[model samples]
Target: MPGVMDIKRKIKSVKNTQKITKAMKMVSAARMRKAEDAMKNARSYANKIYELVGNMADRVEADSHPFLTARKEVRNVCLAIITSDKGLCGAFNSNVVKKTLAFARENKGVNIKLICIGKKAYDFLGKKEFEVLSKYVSFGGKITYDEASEIGDKLVDYYMSEDVDEIYIIHNEFRSTAFQVAKVTKVLPLSIEKTEAAETTDYIYEPKAEVLLKEIMPRYINFTVYFSLLESIAGEHGSRMVAMDNAARNAGEVINKLTLTFNKARQGAITNEILDIVNGAEALNG
Candidate 1:
């Protein structure tokens, strides 16, 4: 068994750790609220644009947009994996990396490349078999639409130039503070669809549907990239908040246990001292 002093030191160390965890939890909580609000607001715009683009794309000819044209063979593929730059966020980054690796394994023969959005993703996947075309990081746990658009421009260029036959974005979609699901979205060779309302509604475009789509398609691409990045930021904050909360609670539990041990050790030392004093007195009297 450890001595009383050692146990006391352990308890003090745990308490210090608990303080850090609590601070991190509080910071993550505050950031989560802002990130979630931004993500939620963007979701509305994302939904609206998705619907608007789908309806417009359906009315236009396939030849009108390169996005509408499907590649004959998907030889080269690009996977854009979004994650947090830092750790201590539970499995948020790992899950996304796992999803990306799974995708690579499933498609064995295809030439796969990478576009990593965070340091974690690049740090992990950069050493892997896939070629990392680009990496963007160091946002300090905060992200903006302008940054997303800049990345989007890179993706647009890659797709338009036929550098990659298909493009997918892997990320964690925020469900709740405690839950996040990794998702892979195929963004290139755009999958245009007709909404339920579009199937029946007959309307004419202000200019021309094809002309409108020509302008709107690129925006849709940018929005998709931006929204995914927002989702990742929100999810990162939520995951980190939960992880830090758990860490703080565990630290408290450890401190409680250590205190108990320290008290027991101190009590044992006191009992031993009393016994020693009584025995010495008896010997002296004898």
Candidate 2:
């Protein structure tokens, strides 16, 4: 049995922890709402841009641009992994890391180059023997379009340089406040499926098809990267918010249980002292 002082100290510690968890839960919930709104507003424009680009690609010959070309032998692959910078989110980082490892395993022998966008992914993959080509972890809690553009520029450079045969983005797409789906979307060599999404009847080019293709092609890739980052941000916030809520609830439970234990211990001590006093008094009377 712990001394009364020890029991009291434990209860005080638990109370402090509970307060912190509750505060964190509130903060996360507020951030999650803002993130969700940003994602929703950005998604439509992002989708329409890609769809328009795809439809234009459909009308033109496949070999009009090099980015549209799909290679037969995939020797080198670039994986752009998106994860949260910090963790407190339950299983958010783990899910992405596990899927990425599985992807690496499945695509054995192909030279895998990693492009990590978050600190969590960078740290997790850095520990492994994988080849990490580039890492961008500067994005704070808020992800801006500039950050996305910078990341996209690297992918474009890699693809244009022929350093990587295929580029894929693996991220958790924001589904709901409590749900996220891990998705791997091919971002380079501009898949025909993407072109199919934007299929249109006829289109007029401001300049020659070649010139327009050159201009629009890179933007399409940049926008895709941007969209992914935005989605990932929303998903991260949602996961964190839910995780914090759970943590706060669990902390409350712990405090409740500890308080009960403290009370029991204190009561036991008091009862023993009373018994001792009573026994002494009886002895004196005897």
Candidate 3:
């Protein structure tokens, strides 16, 4: 068994760690609220645009718009992997990485390109044997629409020029404060099945489906990218907050165990000293 002083030192160390985790938990919770609001506000717009595009695409021939046209054969794929710039968020980053890896293996023959959005993704996938078109990081737990627009523009150019046959966004979808689900969303050659609600509704074209699609298609792509980033940011913060809370709880448990060990050790030492004194006094008297 370790000495009482050693146990005391360990208890102190664990306490300090617990404090840090608690602080992180608080910070993450605040950021999560802010990000979550942005994500929520964007949800309505994203859904409407999604519905509009899907309905319009269904009305016109698929090949009428470049964005809606699918390639004959998928030769190259571009994956935009979104993750947090930092760690200590439990399995948040690892989950996205695992999903991405599975996707790569499933399409092993295809030439895979990468667009790494966060440091975690870049640190892992960027160093691999893939062509990384771009890498973005250092957002510091916040991102603006302009940054997302820049990334969206790059993806647009790549798709228009046939740089990649397909583009997919691999990111975490914000489900709740304690849970997030990783999703693989296709970005290029856009396809959305008409929902029951949308199927019942019919729309009259303003200028023409082709003209509207040509003008609004790029904006749709850019907003899609921006919305994905917002979702990812919110999910990351929620995951981190939950992770830090769990860490703090675990540290508290360790501190309690260490305290128990410390008290037992101290008691043993005191008992031993008492025995020594009693024995010496008895011997001297005898």
Candidate 4:
């Protein structure tokens, strides 16, 4: 049984914690709205770019470009992992890391290259057994297309150099505030269907279709990376908002329980004091 003083102190502490969690929940909720809007806006452009690139790739011979060429065995594979820099977002980062690790484990014999986006991912995968090629940390819980472009540039350079035979991006796709989908996308050797879809469309080229492809293909890759980053940002904010909301609710419940305990303890103390006074008065009078 806790003393009245101790119970009061605990109740006060829990109330303070509840206030903080409530504020955090509100802040994350506001940010989530903006993040989600940004993601939705970018998706249309990303889809357009992919559709155009896929169509263009069809007009030319599949062997016309190295990027469109698919190889039999993947000697080296690069995994671009997007994660949050901070914790307290429930299991957002942990789940992504888990899925990534599972993929890495599944491809045991192949050389696994890592391109980590967040500090958490960099730290988590940077240790032994993983080859971290590049990392970009400190996006400040938000990221922009420019930051995404820099990462895309690094991946393009690596892919063109044939350093990695296959490139895959691992990220969380925003479904709703409560849900996110873990996704792994193949970045290179643009899908055959996308190319065929492009081939069927008829259009007049200004200079040449191949020339346009030279310019557009790289941009397409960049846009794909950028979109993935945006999706990741949206997912992070959504997850954080949901996590903080739960935290606030849990804090409220705790504070309520503690207050109940404090009141009981105080009532017990008062009852004991009254009993002591009555007993003393009776003994003195008798």
How do the residues 1-286 of candidate 3 rate in per-residue lDDT, one tens digit apiece?
8988889999999999999999999999999999999988888999899777777876777788888878999999999999999999989999999999999999998999999999999998887888999999998988888888899999999998999999999999888988899899999988766455545455677888789889888889899889988988888989999999999999999999999899999999999999999999999999
Q: lDDT of all the models against the reference?
A: 0.88, 0.85, 0.90, 0.83
Residue-wise lDDT of candidate 2 within 88-148, one digit each (tens)? 8898888899989999999998999999989999999988988899998968778777878
| Candidate 1 vs 4: which has more lDDT | 1
Which of the numbered candidates is closest to the native, going by highest lDDT? 3
Question: How do the predictions measure up, each by TM-score?
Answer: 0.96, 0.94, 0.94, 0.95
Q: Give me the candidate number with maximum TM-score.
A: 1
Q: Write the per-residue lDDT of candidate 4 for residues 4-76, one digit (tens) a residue.
A: 8888788788778878877887887888888888888987897788667756766777787778888778899
Q: lDDT score of model 1?
A: 0.88
- For 1-286, candidate 1 gives per-residue lDDT tens digits of 8988888888888899999989999999999899889988888898899887777666667778888888999999999999999999999999999999899999998999999999999999999878989999898888778888889889989998889999999999888888999999999888876444546575777787777777887888888998888888889989999999999999989988888888888899999999999999999999
- Residue 93's lDDT within candidate 2 is 86
Error of 1 at 156 (Å): 0.6
